[model samples]
Target: WLKPFWLKGTSSSQRPGNLYSRPLPPAAMKTLHQEESIKVPKGIKVTIKAKHVEVTGKHGTLKRDFRHLPIELYLANSGHEVRAKMYFAKSKQLSMLRSVCS
Candidate 1:
């Protein structure tokens, strides 16, 4: 009798996976903290107080409250720039952090 095509191998250990597979090194851990800074234009005024921000320009003014946001917002670089920062973020929260920073 003729053996099947797959059965032509020497044994289970002779399979391609067994011959090529290897234990890879552990992956590096993801960062938990992220920070992004944005510059403010000379003609525009940005005000940051706690989690609240107000942006004023020649056209109009905008106010926002970020107390419910997962990330933290602040003014930096001598109040000439704004920063978005997040701390202790995991996989799920990483998306949120990136979305806000973007």
Candidate 2:
């Protein structure tokens, strides 16, 4: 069986930098929380912010950063599936988080 395309890193550069990086800082968490306040479609919403990514839906919100992470978004409802979209700036690999939302 083939795994989802999003599960695989889009680019080699996106791989983790280090194995022991700490969790997201308080400031990043605040930004993530604020980002999650925005409305989304009926399905679970997953937003990739500048410093982190926020997942919001019926179950609630969970935030995480790319420092030490995996490329997976698990939604509570089986009917609801995750959609991964990437927005880039000048270079394809570099993207602005806010732009991806809109």
Best by TM-score: 1
Error of 1 at 24 (Å): 18
Tens digits of per-residue lDDT for model 1 on 54-92? 999999998988778778888888778889988776667
After superposition, candidate 1 runs with Cα above 4 Å error: 1-30
Clashing pairs in 1: none
State the C-alpha lDDT per candidate. Answer: 0.78, 0.44
**What TM-score does model 1 achieve against the real structure?**
0.62
Query: lDDT winner among the candidates?
Result: 1
For all predicted structures, in order, the TM-scores are: 0.62, 0.26
Model 1: lDDT of residue 77: 80
What's model 1's lDDT at 16? Answer: 54
- The total number of steric clashes, by the backbone 3 Å criterion, in model 1 comes to 0
